[model samples]
Target: MTPFERSRGSWTFPFPGLSLARSPPDDRPTFWTRALGETPEVYGERLREQDDATWRAIDPTRSKLGAALCKGLRELPVPPRGRVLYLGGATGTTASHVADLVGRRGGVYVVEKSPRPFQRLLDVARRWPNLFPILGDAREPRTYLSWVPPVDALYLDISQPEQAEIATDHARLFLRSGGGLVLALKVPSLRKGGGRGPLSPAEEASRSLSRSFDLGPSVSLEPFHRGHFVITGHYRGTGREA
Candidate 1:
């Protein structure tokens, strides 16, 4: 199935919180334009000229995609022209940067369930050629599994009480054997009680993933954002083991 391919014309989806506008002027300031230390005008100019088929934004307030991009560039073993599956791709912000990094030869499959954010994601995909956006629930991998086969890396940024489980399910089904995974788990979302918990949210997530994969190094994005943890790991075995 592979979902729909990227197109240049306008398209619509059922995203709840997305507000689509005509592509902003080259001078309009975007959060990412600032975060990456590029003037809005400069960033906008570059975006306008970029011919890549896939592009998206990296909203800092909503997810740690921006922070993880900054950190992953320094730490993660992201290879050039690699494939990436981005879960919880709200509004396509972070997905865009990833597309840029991977370039035209590579690909990014962005799955977002929220109708609001999915709307914006649709809009961004119009210009970026390498980005493939799927408007569906990430929890139900079977729904989109046929369309999304194994990839070199799986990046998740879903904020839900069962985030760890959701991420693991995707990895088990779609991640290539020995592929890497980047999970941005939101602690508060997983809180069982109002404030009376013994094990922290992070601890629970780590333990859950360890059941299947060999959990690797993890880093808290507190220095860049609050209450976010980026955990990275590899699938437990070769294709034969699974």
Candidate 2:
């Protein structure tokens, strides 16, 4: 099989983090850079050569979601042409990849609380018509609930101790039956116990999610993104009482 080979089109890549890696838009050379790092000068997108096709490089090493997928994620669970509620879309790096996955028929409603990141999300939304960026706090789903339509999936990348609670609130308000969800749990942000092992904050989050969502297999984003766990699943039952 060719490196470019996948179940999807020629533009797509097998790596889920990078939905599709087309030849770099420009002739600019692309090289690896650390995630969340600032570059010295403005450089256009770069192409990564696998076989004959030069793929666009959306480094999974640079993204936590991408790292999790590289570590061993199974499925996206996001249906084609489905609506999605994206919580904590920061600058649209991962969100942009997700928007590509959904395509024009599908839409992603991104909620960002802070203004700085929200501005970046807006820029990404402009390029991708399917993306809808909303500047609102995720703590209160009702605050921006009207901006988002009922969705088939929900993705959260927020960094707060109340990650699970926040996910539950948004899920109840937006996700429909059998809807998919991917929650990125920032383990270190959660309260740390006296000792640590493979045990993660997602465990508590998953247990909390049991009240409503049936979770799928979870994996840790170690080495690439230490102290992060990825959770995938769908809404299952009425959530736990407050």
Q: Write model 1 residue lDDT over 1-242, tens digit each, in one string.
A: 11222221232322111112233344322222211112212124233222322223444444475565444323453344668889888977667666665656767899999899888787777766777999988878789877875677788887777777776777777777777777887777768522255767788778888876677677767767777778878776443221
Cα deviation in Å at residue 72, candidate 1?
Answer: 8.1
Candidate 2 — which residues are off by over 4 angstroms? 1-55, 192-200, 238-242
Model 2: per-residue lDDT, tens digit, 1-242? 33333333432233332333222344322222211112211123344444333334445555666666556676767876678888889888777666656666888899889999888777777667788889988988888866777888889988788878887887778888788889888777776521144545556677878777888888788876778778888887442222
- Model 1 residue 103 CA deviation (Å) reads 1.7
Q: How close is candidate 1 to the true structure, as a TM-score?
A: 0.69
lDDT of 1 at 215: 72
**Cα-based lDDT for every prediction:** 0.62, 0.67
The TM-scores, one per candidate, come to: 0.69, 0.76
